[model samples]
Target chain A: MVESLSLPKDLVLGSAILTVTGNSDLYIENYKGILLYEDCCILLQTKTCQVQIEGCNLSIDYYNNEDMRISGCIRQIVWK
Target chain B: MNRIIIWLKGYVKVRLSGFSPERFMNLCGNRSIHVWGVENHGRFYILYMSRKSFLQLRPVIRKTKTKVAIIEKYGLPFFMHRYRKRKLFFAGILVFLMILLVMSLYIWDIRISGNYSKTSDMILKLLSDNNYKYGMRKSKVDCEAIEKLIRAEYNDVTWASARIDGTCLIVELKENEILRQEETVEKPSDLIAEREGEVVAIVTRAGSPKVRKGDMVSANQILVSGAVPVLDDFKTLVGMQYVKADADIYLKTRLPYEYSLPFLHTEKEYTGKKRYDGSISLFSKNLKFHIFDNPFPEFDRVEDTKQIRLSEYFTLPVTVTLRTTSEYRTVKKKYTKEEAAALCKENLKKFLDDLEEKGVQIIENDVKIGIVGENCLAKGMVDVILLMEKRQDTEMVTVTVPEDNRETEE
Candidate 1:
């Protein structure tokens, strides 16, 4: 029914919303799962795309099912 | 505000050394455990999670075969846990707070205001003897009783009031300096002119008005006379009755003044170097510590002092005093005759303003300013009108004659 109304998935279906502040703070909302996690890289799976965050010292400030806050010296973020 | 919320919810930083720490974190997330502050250090994953979630991570740790070590603990729960052993110390703090609260309910200080002739110590002693001393509970203070007691003991206090202001007891008093003298002896009086002048206006509220508007009155003339003649039919001579005459009479009079001002004046011109000195004053003594010397020979100093009050009507002994000084060079300023005359006119205007404030109406002003040698001389004469009242109490004397003289007059 939501898809028939033709509303944005992120707004109607509560899909993933990613926000980055400066080069040190990264926040993700409505994420589905985490695929790859390492010292310098983190991979987050959303309903529609994959969020690849590459940083020097990537660390998760906080993470739950609804929202997550990642803090480190972020070098790049890619959506695929 | 956010920090307070975070402090209430205890958190801890944990270092996880396992094959797949992210999987362990995901399991924890699935179980509704909120995790934060994840950092990568080689193979070990450092993360922060709430203290509640950290305790519930045993199953996840076992499943992932990870080594968990708490790096740091944060928030109030941990604080309470750390100080749980010091039960006596916490009890001592609680007792101290209770004592402070209880002490604040009583009077800690007393202040007196509006007192003259009678010393404050006498009033304090009077209050202490009447059970209104310091440390007395504010709720127990009988304000009306204390005021009455002070008034009765002093006899000179016209009015008195005692009130509790914060932690201080404030005693307000008004002293009667005149002590109700011969003024209470009422006598029939008349309002008379103090000096000779033309009457401008007359408003009589009591008795008969002897003078009208624009009437030229003489010195010591009765403007409102107290003596009123009571007569019967046929216009015969009758008895004289007296009354207290009250009236407002405005008179037209002239006031003259002369002033001389020098053309050259000495004025201080600021050089823009300013210094501020601050001191803490305790009990009227200023304690100042300064490491710098006065760099200028000539300067202007302005001192301002304010008392530090703990509450309204409760001033503490300590005060912060701040003084600012500006360096200036004294220079001789040469003024033109017009400028000097302007200065003199300003002075004259100020004098006239003062007179106007005292109910004087300026009718005409004849003023002249001119250069007399190097100084400017200003001469002015202002005609002003104001109400003047003067009266004296006198006993009415009766004249008695001898029997032969009385018979002859009859």
Candidate 2:
């Protein structure tokens, strides 16, 4: 019914969102928690699955309860 | 802006050592602790959090079994704490700002514009006489009142306006271009000869003619009379009427000119030796301090002074003067005959040009230059046709006339 009404899936289903800006920065929204932090990789648990981000010199620019912004030379992002 | 706010609130860079640093961050996120700029060094994790959040991190650190230590403290709280011992420097900055604020409350500069017939010095003198001058409190100055005062004091000023803009008092003025209208409505007077000369031309604008062309008149002789004799039907003098006398009377006169120049004169010549020095002066307080030394026997000191000002209108009392002293020696110079004659002719031409500039027509020049002994003398008379303005009060007369003969024609 929501799909027939053309409602946005991210807002209706409450799924985690990953926004990439160019090749330098990434913004993650509605994430559950930070799972692991390292210089080359960062893992996060979202509502549906675990999200992993692999990068060089990866650092969190800012983070609050609902969202986090990461900035570095990003290599890849995977969801499992 | 958010970063500035965080810096203002103060923050600390914390280093977490032990297991599960990620859990520590997750616990901090759940507890509503704001953290940012997180980096990892394999053995420990480093992150930044607000000073208040760091105080509430005991439970999160204990839960994750991570030992945390503040590696670096940042922001305003730490800055103020570090400079807590140098209280005088901070106090000096506050006092300087207070002085600037106080100074802005009073006027420092006054500027007058758009005046041609009346000089700016005249208007400035009037303003100072009426207690409106530099250093006066700005609130006490009423712009409308100043406008009214300026218009009332100056008869030629047609429009006047005064305003205060950022410690500067500006006065704008417009003057009447018809400046000679007062002569037509002036008191009854007679036009007299200002110099002993033969009358060349006369144009009567208001008065009755007392002298004609080619009439030789002495100084103080009446050239035109303000009184007019009224005639009756029989062409007999009945009474006299008075009006202001105005006329253009040109006089042909001889102006005696004599100039003497010494053939041998002492002139100072520069020796190319110069000394540069400076001084600081407080003109408002009449205090001057100079640092200079001149070893030359004879020198000319040229000093240039400049006032300290933040802008055109925000001038201060401090002045800096740079003094330049150039050494010189006097030498005796002898003039040749041709040089003396040429110099004499140039001076005579300059004199004639000056007379022409003053509206005096140069009719003829009969100057002769002769070098006598050690001096060059130029003596001659210049014929000039000059219009003179001189007046005397007309005498009031009493006359008896018949009632029927009292017909007035103006």
Candidate 3:
């Protein structure tokens, strides 16, 4: 399931992300559009794009092409 | 261009830069748009184009704007930087006004004071001649040079200085002081009898008594004299007199004049023509003009002149005046012996008449005439001396002790 969640108030979307307790190493994506990355930030087009993540204590990895990866303790998943 | 216009139709505003009024007008070239106005500020150029053309030519104009730095740098931002753009113009106007104010404060007129004999007109002329004149700029006038020139011309000036105060050039002068010689007072001196006769006047100021009036006294004899007395309380053994004495005495003398003449003509002569010139000096240079010249050469000439220096030290020439005189010559005729004698007697009578007017008494007279060298000459001499009486009052101070004081002291 794609877990949808509202961004935390203290979290900056481009610089960091939040993790919930649910899944880990879950493969996911039914993307509506390409999420381009620039300057360590993600640009999501059309608001309907979704992604699934497995982990709680999520570790984020930044890519040279300005993309971000998520891993670690999973708590729950959400989609919107 | 049509495509560019279609592309620009979507935007509400278009900006153009780097185009001056002339250049912009040239570019407009038959484009229908009202020209509002043109504004110039030194090297900066700003042209306003209507929205229609601005949009239509945006692509082409933008290419032009990039080529010109004034456009690319200042064009778009000038509207937002209005204050900075007007600063230079305002500063230039302020500087120009300041210069005008300074120039107006410079001296325009030079006024002199403390001048009596030196006329204002002459002083002004002198100043003008020395390049320190009216309407001359203050910076152009050298005060030292003016002072030197004036001092050189006017000798009576003790000192002179010039200064510029606002629009006035003030020239202050000090005149030289004239010194008068002191006269010496005569001490006690001999007052001798004036003439050989009786003492007529005796006025003793500070001397002992000598002789009284009506006393026969010879010339050089003391009348009211100069001698002081030393006395004892018993009123004895001291004698002296201090007196100023005068006397008038009568004397008789014999003198003769002879005249002889033959009928002969004599020439009468008169003076010659005269001319006078007036001169004034300024800055050591003299300006002179002759006021009068004798018209007749045969006439005798006489000239009179007066000169005064306006300043004592500077010795500036204030004014010089001269008078000229001319006299003509006339012929004279000779007279026979009889006529000569009669003329001599007439002349003698006229002389005696003059002497009578002067209070002289003629006691006796003798006359004679002789012919010599075909001319008649009359000779006569008269002896007469004045007899006059003068009385001079003498002041005598007598100090006497009162009888009551003497008795009381005794």
| Candidate achieving the largest lDDT | 2
Docking class of 2: medium
List candidate 2 stretches off by more than 4 Å. A1-80, B1-102, B113-133, B139-160, B172-185, B273-283, B293-303, B322-327, B395-410
What local lDDT does model 3 show for residue B394?
A: 42
Worst 10 residues of 2 chain A by lDDT: A8-17
Q: Put down candidate 1 lDDT per residue, B1-410, tens digits, no spaces.
A: 97688779888988889788778877887899877667777868787888888899899999989999999999999898999999998899999889657756777678899997778998888888778876678899888998889888987788999888877888999988687453454577888887788998888887678889999988888888776655445343345567777788898977787989988889999999998887887645778854335757998777777766555755455668677888999999989877898899998899889988987888888988888988999897889887877885533433343465546558
Residue B252: error of model 3 in Å?
9.3
Kindly report, for each predicted structure in the order presented, the TM-score of its chain A compared with the true chain A.
0.82, 0.91, 0.30
Candidate 2, B349: how far from true, in Å? 0.8
TM-score for each model: 0.55, 0.55, 0.29
Candidate 1 Cα errors over 4 Å, as ranges: A1-80, B1-145, B151-165, B171-190, B226-244, B269-279, B283-301, B309-315, B325-332, B389-410
- Write down the C-alpha DockQ for each prediction: 0.53, 0.65, 0.00
Tens-digit per-residue lDDT, B279-356, candidate 2: 776535545444457558888999898877777777655678888999999989988888888888899889988999
Interface RMSD of each: 1.2, 0.8, 25.8
Q: What lDDT would candidate 3 get against the real structure?
A: 0.49
Candidate 3 global Cα RMSD:
33.9
